[model samples]
Target: NLPFSFIFFNGASRLYRSEDFGKTFTDVSKVLKNYYIRKEFGINVGPENSKKVILTADVSKLKAGGAIFRSSDSGETFEFINLPFHPSQGMTFHPSNPSQLLAYLTGVLCCLDDVNARGNLHLQRTTDLGKSNTKLHTNIYSFGFAGQFLFCSVIHNQSLPRSILVSVDQGDTWNEAQLPPVSHEQFYSILGADNEMIFMHVDEPGNTGFGTIYTSDDRGILFSKSLERHLFVDSSGANDFTNVTSLRGVYITNVLDINNTIRSVITFDSGGEWRALKRPSNSQCDKTAKNPEQCSLHIHSTYSISQKVDVPVPPLTAPNAVGVVIAHGSVGDVISTLLPNVYVSDDGGYTWWKALNGPHYYTMLDSGGLIVALESHPDRAVQVIKYSTDEGQCWHSYNFTNETFMFVGLVSEPGAKSMNVSLWGYKQENLYKTTWLSYTIDFNELLTRDCDERDYVLWLAHSTDFGSRTDGCILGCKERYQRLAKSSVCRNGRDYELSKEQAFCQCTLADYMCDFGYYRVGNDEKCVEQSDLKDKVLEFCLKGKEEQSGSWSRCGVERIVEGQTRPQGLGLD
Candidate 1:
């Protein structure tokens, strides 16, 4: 059950741990705390050494102004290994040597252990691991040591995409990988898929549609085949493309397989070819601004390299089955809602299926193998979370207690032990998490109930409760159908049949509800109900109603109190 592991998070101190994978952890904060305020990158664990564990960390910029930490005693403590010339963006341990290490710093590069630091781009040699180093080049963004070649992605400018650079000589000059058509303009991010393959997600100039792909056959150079449609959006692009799996490069269409020389680029072949590779489709760049229910292709990768952009939906298919109902800020398609009655296909946009209907609120692929769907029903006092392990065939339900919500989103930030998933409410403003079942979200303490004019809750709450604040009551009046459905009779308390317009009048009080024999019914003046004719007659009786025959109708025959013969019409009438 434990998976040969243990894990912990102090919450207060922000300390975390996991056991069963290694015997000990080493810390190196002492060497790093002198430079920056805190660290950005955290500790990394390696294999056992002398009954001790190896750990690495990049200090938060606030703690020591950008330093790295290494630990050896299972994270109980740590020590400084060495400092490079500049702050490091990434770090890794050498496969053969215990002390030999590689670190990448912003604007500078180094391969060091405990004594010296050097390297600009291609390679930085360390005779004693961290003991000594030298600068090789100046244009590299990230580097990795694989086989006989030292590989790197180089960028002329940070705003521009970096090309793949490789060096046969250790820490010496490097040459750019020359592919075709796709230039540095198309290359945005690069990741070493494995020891042999390098994967780059291409981005275009203005960030429009899918970017292409280029493969490295030998090492970094000699990239062949301008693999079109393999492009992904960067962080800025991801903002517009809301789906998480898209930016992470987990789409089904974007393939990263190797056949000795990394041939067979699928996306470049055709949209049809990309469709054939579909398993569970990965998220892709969304073309439309307001269609999130549409399912896009999602890809999965074994290597820990950064993810590519969201995958696109194949062409000429039925609309997405993301369903008709949608709650704002809900996760899933984050784009168009595909048709409800359609099936998935595998040969590039030519496919079909009649699957389950999609929910509008929060949706998560749960660790328990279920896809949990949450809805925006505030009157229920809790948001509903439904789970479906077998895609959408069946579902189970869980109510999120102690929180008022309408829509939800689940996302994660990488952690020391495991990934952390944060549950975000659309209108709630406060975020929550439940790594353990007994999850306590101190959302009340973190959220302010003060209604802001610009806040989303201004429109989402129930209308009867609008203008008057109450817990779990969303703004705006309840929908007409919902209010009518809850009543005992067809017309609620009235015996009259209700029309959509009439229901709207009774609830919201529109002006046109007045008629000839009816009176304006509700306080807001929208509905009409029959008035009592008898009450009107009684009130007019003393005034003497005119007879139908045009004769005067006297009140008590000219009141006999005076006993004088007065004109009949002059008595009290």
Candidate 2:
């Protein structure tokens, strides 16, 4: 797979390209025009060809006019493409055909006189990258391509039930599929992993109302309800039904009951049978709470679940893992202070475990690894990044010093071994700036680690190219390289900082020598700095150092005794 990656920075109105697995990025904003790109709608790269990429931008804040831009040479340059409609949304390319593209134009008037047209919202298709266009369908709320068939949820009118339309000839002709019995208040459909199945959700309003989810195995020909009555109490209603479906007919949904409790359920046979997931336990809260009722474990919709901050909440199923699901409790709760903030379930949401604590956002890498960026503590300003390989059973932490950035989200490159970490930052009055960082940890590497001291050091050294075994090292070397690379004083040693700064300062070898802020200790053959050494040690303990009493230790190491257990090679040997 190609190493090329691109990210749009909303605040700067620019795009960046990273060819080295997101380890480094170069400003590629020249390829884009002066228009503001829509990051929310997303940038599309051709599935079959990484060289072919497309982007959409708004001419003005009012969305007066819009433009589509294309790059044929892997984002080296871009050219403007013409669109039949302005202010469009949901830009997508054909699954197999790079030449074919589809975009949804909702609430945009085709003609000023046709304001009353029922088909005001229509889908436009193009085979030549927008040189011309053909209208595909109207009144479409959402559309997706699964294998060769294209599925769309169309709303004809309020009085009529919303229909699920399928097109087998690549949007040429459409047919309505039979669905379950439910009110047409709203309908949403998404294609399963392949085109073999489709999942639909219908919302019914008013009392005695409930949302019904259906599954279609015959390419949207016929649908059947997947939920059983016993899952919900008699006469009890449900709302806020969110689901994710896999290619193997595994479906997961988050249902909020009338009593405000949120239950996560999963079905393996396309909803033929369902199992409710168990809420993660809070042992610390149970032991310390005054009221026993406050210690009970349950997932509630209102204050129990964490509201998504800047980044989008993670879906039920890991994008890369078949049956894994990660969930967390809400922030700003008294009971949450004694509970882990994150939980994970590997058996399709049947069981759970407390993974980590603190405010953070996480995403699953294409390699089935999980990455999280969390605050050092609930009250601290420092943010640290953590990685979990064994499905969140244990984690390794990395702290970025001198970098003021917020975690945006993680990007999984299709068919690639590495994933890109998107972060946002600001520089004096502009708080919307963004940057892309790469995590080069491969799935194989994570699988081989034993989580021991030697394995940890080896992984850190190899992944960040830190110092040799004999030399001192910088904790979070990758992040340090990023922060120092941006400084005017340290820009000269950017390459060395990234690859060689972790080792002893070899003043004799110019290429392998240490950067600024590092000095060689006389006659010691090693680079040493009083301030950096303290920072490195402090970082080590801040990342879950253990004490002799079998208790969790942080920010400091306990005194070591003969035959007592402690981290080997402490104090940098």
- Best candidate (score: lDDT): 2
Candidate 1 at 196: error in angstroms?
Answer: 5.0
lDDT of each: 0.32, 0.47
Candidate 1 global CA lDDT score? 0.32
State candidate 2's TM-score: 0.60
Error of 2 at 382 (Å): 2.6
Best by TM-score: 2
TM-score of each candidate structure, all chains considered together: 0.41, 0.60
Q: What is the lDDT of residue 524 in candidate 2?
A: 33
What lDDT tens digits, residue by residue, belong to model 2 across residues 472-525?
222111111111110111111111111122332211211111221232342232
What's the CA RMSD of model 2 in angstroms? 22.9
